[model samples]
Target: MLTIDSLSHRLSSYLEPTQINRVKRAYYYAEQAHAGQYRRSGEAYITHPLAVANILASIHMDHQSLMAAMLHDVIEDTGIGKAAISHQFGEQVANIVDGVSKLAKIEYETQAEKQAKNFQKMAMAMARDLRVIVVKLSDRLHNMRTLGALPAEKKRRIAKETLEIYAPIAHRLGMNDWRIEFEDRGFAAMHPLRATRLHASLQQVRGNRKTLVEKIQAAIELRLQRESIDGLVIGREKHLFSIYNKMRSKHKSFKEIMDVYAFRIIVEDIDTCYRALGAIHNLYKPKPGEFKDYIAISKENGYQSLHTVIIGTQGVPIEVQIRTKEMDELASRGVAAHWLYKSSGDDDSASAGSYDRANRWIKRLLEIQQHTNSSVEFVENVKIDLFRDEVYVFTPKGEIIELPAGSTPVDFAYAVHTQVGNTCVACRINDRPAPLSQQLESGQKIKIISSEKSQPNPNWLNFVITAKARAAIRHYLKNQRHTESVELGKRMFMRALTNNNLQFDQLNHDQITGLLEKTTSESLDEMYESVGLGRITALTITSILLPDSDENRDGTGITPISIESPDSLLISFARCCRPIPGDPVVAHLSTGKGVVVHREPCKNVSDLRSKKESLSDISWSPNVTGEFLTIIRVEVKSERGIIASLATRIANTGTSIEGIQVDERDAENSVITLTVAVTSRVHLANVMRSIRNMRSVTSVGRPKT
Candidate 1:
């Protein structure tokens, strides 16, 4: 039903005669290109682009954006090319259209991979020109609005993608109109039952509280007039998705969601905004700890308001937001307000400031993309960075750094600079020494302690919340693993050579090159790194470097066993079965895991036994002495001091209990599992026997291999 005339009419408000003509030219060109195509709804495809252009026009986007929206699908959906678009329109218009198009020439392994690649391309385009995303959002908005025409499964998939990807992006860019609508529409499509229930509940509440809300609005308007304040008091109901989220997250019923009905007081200036807040607080008792003054410290998205909850008549709680007209416009329209102002040729500093503030996150997204490699990783990190509850902390210099909730000092350091994060050793929070993983709170001043020798610890990846921090830590740890693996591989290769009675100096360049080629490695360092990383065994490379003249007649081959040295970092015991000095064990060559010693009956060993070449005959040396973890289950009478008695008996055997868990329990007895550190299987057996000797403990045995 929508047509190009409606789009032209919407654009005519701000666009000049010349620009309006250009837009019309673009629309006709796109119309011809998409003449024979039809959408799922059986409507002419030109309607879709026109509808998309109309959506942008509603936000007062510039003529170029509107034209780009109109012609966005021409090159991708039609025989037209970017060159044709450039010849018809200008290069900028052609570039914008091309930016919105997905890479159709490439094949992808999966739908998710294809989606990730498209998002990657769109992000790059958005970085080059912000208008690309604006138009893209408009395109998505129109598609979502008419999503019912698609198949059920396709509808769900598209709706889910919109909710997860496009909606968050709209929020990050402060496009509240598009963001809220996207969420509401997507929620309705993706979760029809919940959306319907919520809508019905909202409507019922609206019917019941219609008079109350009107009375409250009247009372506030009267009070403001009495104080000689110029204010427009408007009543608002919370968005359905917002209300649903609150109910779901807080586990509250519809009626218990008190802030469902809210009021916004729009004043003329910032001082008046505060004055209005004071007036409202005086009029009604404000709920304690429910007041936030965002005017002093606006949200990262440039939203500023004074939010308060107060007890009104009949003990009913009412939420109120007070802000200036400018704040209200920004809150309602977000970044679209800047476009509106730009299209109207209103170069106001406030509008420009708001635009800049909203765009800071986009710059941060670019930084994240720079540090990330895989499309899936980039998309995932972008999602994490997008949907975060922010906490605003301060640096030593008093500058505010807004980070995601649960972000630690390490995340802060990384947010400050990649170099700072890499070299960060410790932090001082509120002038007290704090762990790097300490979660930061708002208003706390933090100072990062750095040392030139300090490098990122792999453990930091466990707690860092920000995507930037996680990406940087992962990048650093990857490089560190490569370096360490290379060194370990070199040592392993040399040891293999020495065991074979061949000196490393005896190998010539030609032989070394041949070895590298045989191993499919680029250089000696790569070969050594691969061996160290467990990608290949040292014995395999050694055999290639020095093959035996006679073919092997014995079953497979045997490698020397060595687990005695205290500092043998290349060998590690697999925690899956905890093979000790006296336990039957086998060494499995695992990629990037070095030589792993597992119990002979380990499930992993059985699974990998088909590859006989990768198995190495290994055993713990006679002097293999060190503490290893072993799990033992004990059946004990359910009574006080039973755990204490078990612990005492294990300690009496010189073994230390590391962990305990109540695996299963009843009124009479409980199965308690204990993980204790012992020197060998014999030590663990002696400890289990000591625990079994306790009167409270009925039976004790180790878990099956």
Candidate 2:
């Protein structure tokens, strides 16, 4: 009833007879390997591989990839060895199988961890051979299709994994078809009740709109036909998950949302695509500021299309995408489109360039993996790249450098060349001096100014947002610690001589060890390094050597001061905030800076405590004090003159704006959050009440504990 020859009849345009024979052999071998095994659905386990292979074939995979997909699970699930597969098939097929098997072996304690690690591994695999992810995605697609056989928890886990791992990969690769199907299937599996309800609602909408979509398609087709344009027109409903997300995020009802239906036109070439676009605009009114021509500058994942949203019949908004057939294939299948293009005898120069660009990140991955001690670090670094929204900024020469969104000029400098980053003193974006932390927007031209004496600053660690920038800063700091520690140690030892404690130059290495051993430091070099790093305070050691001498320190007081009650305690508000009654509070005491109160959950405090153990014990005073000032966080939507309006509100209650910090530098939805200090509980409450009564205030509350 079924034969490779029969399948070849349909797929021969892509797969040769010899290729079909090889797949048949691989399939039979896989069947034998999984002989008596059965899936939870009680079907032969071998059917799963065949299904995956069929999915690959539908996408027109090459001979070796199809063969590898057929045997991908054998080594992982059926006890088949890699050596045996290598001996049977050539190394190419075995290598792909081994990559999949290795990925399958990396397990984790939690599903979330596993999913993150899996994406990491998938990225690594793609770096090595792009085909690995193609097969893996196809395998995931088949699993998603038959996911009903799994238990509810398993379904949710798998669907969530698809959403996090597979769907994003599909999007990054510009595989729109796979992305839509994967998301829709995952949404259905993960939220069956919600999915069912949305489906019923969509069906109700479709019932009244069937003729409407048909009429729109017919009109567009007639126009295209009149123009003698060769293209394929297809209509699509918006994916349910996407609709649900938009509804939830924008706080709009389903009925209030437009652009539910989209029509895509696939043409033969780029010229034809624009021609079709022109014809559509002539037929219907094109919405302003919604047209995008991705074909000219393709997405990083190699997706290219011309998209426009138009106002159609009955005041309905319809989205239209136009692209060449090759663009559509790549848009639909992403990297899998490479296999199809290769099978169809097209030159792969463009696809190869994309692969090369993506693979360039592998060296960085291996670099990150080497420095990282655990999967958590690996996951964190990889996530920076995974969900990164790209910003395309131009160099002085007009060449584009794409960095993660929110990237600063520091990142741009580093991207230009490591030397530029190392020597960068300042930057001018669009010929205007901007802060090093200023987020570069699209179409901005950046120029980095470097000086021969320039060196990386410790503060750059805060502003540089790219993984490469972060890694470089970390590497520079590591090296600087060794160099600075030696210099600081020499200075401290020389200073100790003045206190009549120890003759530093005359003392042998062993004596220095004795001093270091008291602090649990391994050696004299480490002791000096600690002093140099500011990890071990020089004053603390000086006190150990000279117990009674009051020394004039170069900077902050050398004596480690404690925050005990004084005759007139020098209490100051923490930089984390100026605390008030309702605010979550914490305190920081700098030797010379005095006590600084911060919002307990402030970014600076949270970051300091997690990374710097010395800062962790800082907490609030249970007893309320009229002298202690506190700060509250407020998030308000941006409006005309809202900042002035808010300041007026706070001023109305007689509150002092101790430190009003606006998130003006960020280009996201404008949220004017300011920290105002109040003298007492009553003062803070009054200020909050005044602010809340203002028309612009959206949410006002103390920071969560």
Candidate 3:
């Protein structure tokens, strides 16, 4: 039914000679490069590229993008490379091709990991060069359109990926038209039954509303003609998946979801958009609070449009979007819209700067990759940042900062400045004091109260949003851990002298260094860190340090045994369960790993009892005077500031914490379990009673077992 000549004629007004020549050249080159390749559908593989290029051209892309679109698969499927493409076309086209080609190289161990990492790369690349994603999206669009020949399993995989990754990316880029298509197609492939039902419902609605749409279009066109405003009006039906999402998310029936039918009014200029909006409002009653003027405050992705929802004929709610012809092109094609405007000889140097801010987040990915070594963590961080919902907030000066949805004030503080986040002590939302973990909503003005004395609280790690905030908090905690371990190692070394009946000055540094080297530890300092982290123990080092112990233990009634006794053995504490300050505990001697202490009733420790060979009796020292780790149970009511206030209150008692576990979700009560390090039973009792007296706190006691 459609011919090339007929399609060309339809596009004659916009397709200039230069564009046509490039398209022809690209066609010839792609055809040769993909000569031997055939698609699963039995069509020449070159046809796929051509189809994608045709999609781009339909959106009025310029010559360079068209060339890149045609040659996108040449490098991947064919043996063509970036260098060859650069030699044939210019570096610009080659760059686009290379970006897409790099994305095709990602191989992951899992499907989720693969999809997440692929999207991450694509996102970063698109942020750098928007054209890269436009080309890839167009390519995917064509592939999705022609996926009939693929197996059902493959179809579902690609479709689900498109729904999760591509559609969201399209939405972020503000490609509304393309977004709807991608979502609908993906939804159809993923949920065929739902898609079929939705399609049937839409068909029914279309049949019933045919007369209404015609009457509305005629009325609008006649009015525009009378006003001498030249423009195009196209009716847009709501996509099935979108309707499904709305129904699922909002719990609405199909009939309850208004604005299912909309009209796009494309004109020549911005002034005409407003004029058309006025005209449309005059024709129908406008819905209250349903108007958005994105033209004035364009989104981060360069989307600009005037939107309104109106009660159309028969009290049917209809959405209307007005934009210029250029805006429409950008709205549909997004970054690829650059290609269309570039052919007009417009100076793009100034306009290019508009996209720089959007690309900054992408640049951060490269920065993150440099710091991180593990692929799984990298993929995880990228996914957390990308797929997370967003909340738009304003700074003191009215500058907008978009953060992940459910982001606390801490994330906002970090978004402003890393220093501010690190030192953030308090916050104010809309001129009132708020907690750091308060969920930020759209349009709220926020202010962070910071202090030089303020350090990152471990509790803050539980509630902060945004990957950057989480990563920063984690990094800080790791650094803090290193610092604390170093300090603790020094103290433990000093304290051991009394137990060993040795003077610190009498120990040989060279001998100690040699002992550390045999264990493959870096230095005395590193050995100390290992000891503090419970990797090695005091007895293990004492044996290595005092190996010439014949003089020291000759008449003390003590004999060195090849295997340590199950009783009277020093054990290294497990931080996993952190049998802290005053908890009943026992030890398990792991082969070649020394003794590992655990809570007496801990499942991990209990499981080890079956292996009697590895079992060891561990008891608290009779002279134990310093702090020990204990997990205490504290019950409290869940409310804002409870965690922060509790943490502050606990810290005020000069007690260090091993960890805090909160599960305050039973019957309107919050149960908080805290693992604290305290000097004695007296100190722990005081701390427990103090916590019990605090507001919202009901009961505080040690674990009964």
Off by over 4 Å in 2: 1-13, 105-119, 258-260, 348-350, 360-374, 404-411, 418-426, 436-440, 450-467, 470-705
Candidate ranking under TM-score, highest first, comes to: 1, 3, 2
- Per-residue CA lDDT of candidate 2, range 69-148, in tens? 88999999878898999898889899888777766634333655665566567656777777787788888898899887
For candidate 1, lDDT tens digit of each residue in 1-705? Answer: 677776677777788989988998888988888988998888888998888888887777888888898899888888688898898888998889998886332232347777777877877787777788888888889888898888888778778888898898888777887899999999999899999989998888788888889999999998899889999998977888988888899999888994445899999999999888888988999999888878888878777899999999888888899988878777766777788888777785556766786567777777777778787898888888889978899999999998988999999999889999999999999999999888998889999999997788777888999999988888877777777678767866776777667798999998888898999999888898898777887777777866772322221344545677323445677777867778787877678777788888888787777655477667677888668777898888888877887777778888888899995577888999888888877787788777877888888887776
Query: Each candidate's lDDT (Cα)?
Result: 0.81, 0.72, 0.72
Better of 1 and 3 by lDDT: 1
RMSD of 3: 8.3
Query: Could you estimate the TM-score for every candidate?
Result: 0.82, 0.71, 0.72
Per-residue CA lDDT of model 3 for 72-161, tens digit only, reads 888888888889899988898898987787677343335656655665567566755778987888888887898789999888878877
Model 2 lDDT-worst window of ten: 559-568
lDDT of 1 at 139: 88
The TM-score that candidate 3 achieves is 0.72
Alpha-carbon RMSD to native, per candidate: 5.4, 11.2, 8.3
RMSD of candidate 1 to true structure, Å: 5.4
The number of the candidate with the highest TM-score is 1
